[model samples]
Target: MDDASDKYRAPALEKGLDIIELLANHGEGLTQRELAKSLDRSPNEIYRMLSTLVRRGYVIRSASGDHYSLSLKMFSISQRHPPIGRVIEAALPRMRSLTRKAWQSCHMGMESNGDIVIVATAESPGNWGLALKTGTVVGLWNTGTGRVLAAFRTPEEIDDLIARHRRAVGEPEVVRAEFDGHLARIRTAGYEKMPSATAVGVTNLAFPVFNPSGQVVAVLSCPYLERVDDLVVPPIDEVVEIYRTLANELTALYGGTNPFEKDLTP
Candidate 1:
């Protein structure tokens, strides 16, 4: 190799990054021996690398001292980037607008670290709305927003994310497979309107928000509730149609294409 090539190479940094990416893809984690075997390095060589990664807060060691996994540090770091900021910036107003239109609470979330994290939320105008605060993280398999986000990704990406979500929720592999099928159905339907897995008497309505490449960058979801109000609440079916408009509007605001539009073409 040339001197210039040697100068640009940082072997140690590369090894550390390799470990991080592997753990991220795996989600559950790997043992030190497993990491070494996967990386084609000696355990002792990788031990120092793991130690450095753990100390720098990029990775965490289990209490057993035999396994390793990624910490949330990287996910936190990603939230500070411009793309995430722009997504949040472009989402809040739309979230509120959709909420006001339907008189239901809505939230926006994106997948991170094997979970769907609520980044912004707008409550229904009165005190009768369902409210989930910002920074709340929910499993990817059960939430409507989670399914919408999952439905838009490639199969490989879905597999990886579901594996992690399964580990997080401790659900059975059979359930995981069912969740995969559920996402496929959601893709065909172009939206998800179902009962909340965690809360009762509330229906979850979710739509996908896309980036310029038509990849789902975020999910806009609302928990639909009926109140004994002054007879002005939109029915659940109308709420679903309204969310469709909001999804298309937000997708266009970000210069994103709606994949379902192509499915609808004659």
Candidate 2:
């Protein structure tokens, strides 16, 4: 930033970092031309950097060789760092228990920058269940997990989050008023339950998990599916109750209080 810092700046390294940051915000990936135009650089300038990133496994070139996105390697590296890694370790077992009890797959997501990143996931005990992979970046406004995270935060924080948001691929656009009202409903209900925007016949259930300081640290979400002709599966209501309890236990594990005990006057 200063003259001395500017003098030591490595242009190539900066270009690579710029590319990574851009890709991080845009989960859908971008073409080289798009990346160059957005970064105010010529396509030729970034070609070598892109090639290097692809070689290092930090970026993935789409099958058509036209677009690039951040690879799991970057997310994997972040998971290896402290606190995040520990959080995933602490949540996976509980998530697994929830999946087993509810007979549905579940995932824990946290707000990263402006997107919801799936930090950990647990598959259902049954052979067939929907499960998102860890490290997947989902839309901030179009997902149950993302809404639960926003619903528990202050209005200012939510607005800031909205400002920084970049829509993921195929993420539907939500009007500001509708999004605000949706968050209000989530707050009043103390959780979120709605049909999946991206999948058919799946209802998403999400609850906020708080830290010791009463701030939401993450959200646990289950994509509920009714087994066809399987009468023994837990009912949707029962699954909701089980999932809520699991979220509470996770909050308690972080030394936080039950959000239901607090006034939720949205």
Candidate 3:
């Protein structure tokens, strides 16, 4: 290779990035031997790379021996970027409006590796409220947002997600059966409403936001207190309708050239 080409190339940097990308793409952590095999490198070479990554806080070793995974450092890196930042910014105003209209806490969440992560949230003005902060992570089987996101997935995908979580959390068989029933209802209703699995005396209303490919990329959710005297508690049917409208509007706004034209009729 020429001197200029040699000057531009950095084999060490490339190898480190390859390791990071592989860990990021995998749903589960990779053992040292697995990483070496995937990267076509020796264990010693992979160990040094992994050590540097661990020191830099880009990766962490699991409690179980020799396995490695990416860390919150990746989320910090994404927060500085414009694309995701802008999406959160644009969605906040609408999220706030929805919260005010329904008199409940509302959230904009996206599926990340089979978990629902809240990106934006608006708190209810009432004294009794459902408080879900941004960055809150919820199980794919427990919440309305989780169920709606799961509804868009294929059976194999859902099974994979359930199995992964079952290994991690050891959810009871009865709970799994109930969640399966919830998924069926979400598929039929085109939306999901369930008593809050994460919080007490609250109900979650969730609907999926589709991209231009008719794929569910995100979810919009409202967590409302189950109180009779609350003026902000809109009727269930109206709340569902409003959520459907908002999801359609968001699809149009972000759909770009691949405009989302999915049938959201419920």
Candidate 4:
């Protein structure tokens, strides 16, 4: 380790954070010994850290007193951030407008710990539109918005997210080259569209909201369903155009570039 790095290291804090991250990735609570093994540390080294975390309400200790899991504290704190509030403020009106015109329910989502979490939502004016409620989470490897979010992230981030995704979904390791190929195509397309991976008879149309730095800050997606009763619903092609225009306008307002303008290689 470098001299400067050695000069200021917070060993206790690092152990606490490691515990939080480990629990965040795993569904099952871990016993102290299990945590130690997973983190490659001796159980005695982490016992005090786990106790402090539980006392602070960041980690919950089971009644059996042998296992620990993350509490909702981090999720709660994230909701207090002002930028997320601003994004929701700017997006709600536009999303509501889309619902009226396209007659499809729409939601804004963003990646959170390798999953897409719905942040804002607008229901269709008509009675029969699909809606994914705010706070709902979808897997990184499963949904259209999730793919768009993944496609635009840096290569290293993509790999890390994929690793977490495998843990979250219980899938075998996905070959890196094949996954990268999909992301490259998605980056060129500027969006992702496919039948709903978890639902029947619906299509997911998703686009990214990028910031001025050309980084995606959030995702805008719609669960489109043809209303059999209306008989005048926008066709899928027109729906794509509407979402593209809306996404482009939103991206510009957020001061971000549409990467599709640079390439349509796919």
Candidate 5:
């Protein structure tokens, strides 16, 4: 009665740390048996811990097969908490300025399950604007923002997205080919700009936002209408430059250095 309680204080905390460390050291994911062996724990213990991690969004089961790997929920948590929250809050003022200067609505979106979902939005200064509200889900095959997100993902992720979407939506080969072609262009251009997927005569110009490790985490986009042949203001070059500058600013603010700075120029 005077010994056991003091010695075994928190098994749950220890189990969580063990699972994290095991996954970190393994690089490639481990099955329950392997994880158990590495941690010197029983398979049942490891399985329970893994199940919890998966439920909490800290781990994800591989789509290609049965395996577990770290998820970006940790990143999402960091973005939500302080320090990083301050940075994102500061970045919004600049996003608003860019939106006004370009006479276009702007959106910030992050990739989730292969789709891009808008998390923030700023309206154009003009009375008439092409606006996309926060939480708008962009299709991977059709939008500029979606293309940037798709381009930055790993090949396996791209394949998995395509496969899953195809199964769910029954997309034809022509649609797949079109998306592939857009992806190739995004890689070539180092950014994505195209006519709006959902609205007629509007265009979207987008650049990818990267983290310190050079992984694209989100995208910044401006939605605007194409000017008539007589108009000269808000040139495409100027808008692209603004997008690039915002991308760089966000990168630096978040402790990330730009890897595509040299490649971004026309």
Candidate 6:
């Protein structure tokens, strides 16, 4: 820490923030003793902070009163931020239309600190569809959403994104040469269509959403599932076209150009 900047720190505020950050990573909740041990402090040092957090609705005390986890308050607060709020608001109606047309659930995600964070989603109006919830963090190398986000960036930016990436659990390691080639193909096609790395029997179709500068801002993806029984949906080819149109409409929300109309080679 910088001594000058740290000279007048509020220790209590630091403790409260620390407790909140710790709880965010532990979805199962943590006991007071567990929190203390993780922070290398005594339980008594954090008791008041934890109690305050629970009372204020930022953290939830378990039914047994022994564990603490974050409530939805932080997520609720984050969604109200203007930039993300605008993206979600604009994406939802389009996403709903996409689900209606394609009969598949779709999600919009953006790269944040080298991770793809699903920001908004629309569910299929059909009987069943796979959907990832908002706030889920997915890895860059193993997902169609991640590939589309990286495919439109400059080579240097792509390198830096990979370097800073923290892999999610069960995400496979990347081979730089092969992954580079994969991105090249996405750039060539202006999108990605591949079987999901983590699931069987589903193909993931992803397209880039860009800003006015032609820089990719987010990705719109559909986890495409084919029905084996009597239920029928649009064929994958038609669904891909419908999805690409949705992506273009979203990009237009930012005054972005259509990637299909330009040569994306860099």
Badly placed stretches (over 4 Å) of model 1 are 1-79, 166-174, 262-266
Model 3, total clashes: 0
Q: Per-residue lDDT of 9-59 in model 3, one digit per residue for the tens?
A: 999998999999799667489999999999999999999999999999999
| Order of quality (TM-score) | 6, 2, 4, 1, 3, 5
Please state the error at residue 2 of candidate 1 in Å: 29
User: Candidate 3: deviation at residue 235, Å?
Assistant: 3.0
Root-mean-square deviation (CA) per prediction: 7.9, 4.4, 8.8, 5.2, 12.8, 2.9
State the lDDT of candidate 5 residue by residue for 96-184, as single tens digits. Answer: 88877887778877666555567777887776677677655566677777778788777888888766542112222337677788888
lDDT value, candidate 5, whole model: 0.74
Better of 1 and 4 by lDDT: 1
Q: How do the residues 12-105 of candidate 4 rate in per-residue lDDT, one tens digit apiece?
A: 8989999998997675799999999999999888898898998999999888888899887877777677767767778899889888888888
Error of 4 at 159 (Å): 1.1
Q: What are the clash counts of all predictions, listed in order?
A: 0, 0, 0, 0, 0, 0
Winning candidate number (TM-score): 6
| lDDT (C-alpha) at residue 129 in model 4 | 77
Predictions in order: lDDT:
0.81, 0.87, 0.74, 0.80, 0.74, 0.87
Task: Report clash pairs, candidate 4.
Answer: none
Residue 229 lDDT (model 3): 72
Provide the lowest-lDDT 10-residue window in model 1. 165-174
TM-score of each: 0.67, 0.80, 0.63, 0.68, 0.62, 0.89
The CA lDDT at 147 in model 6 is 88
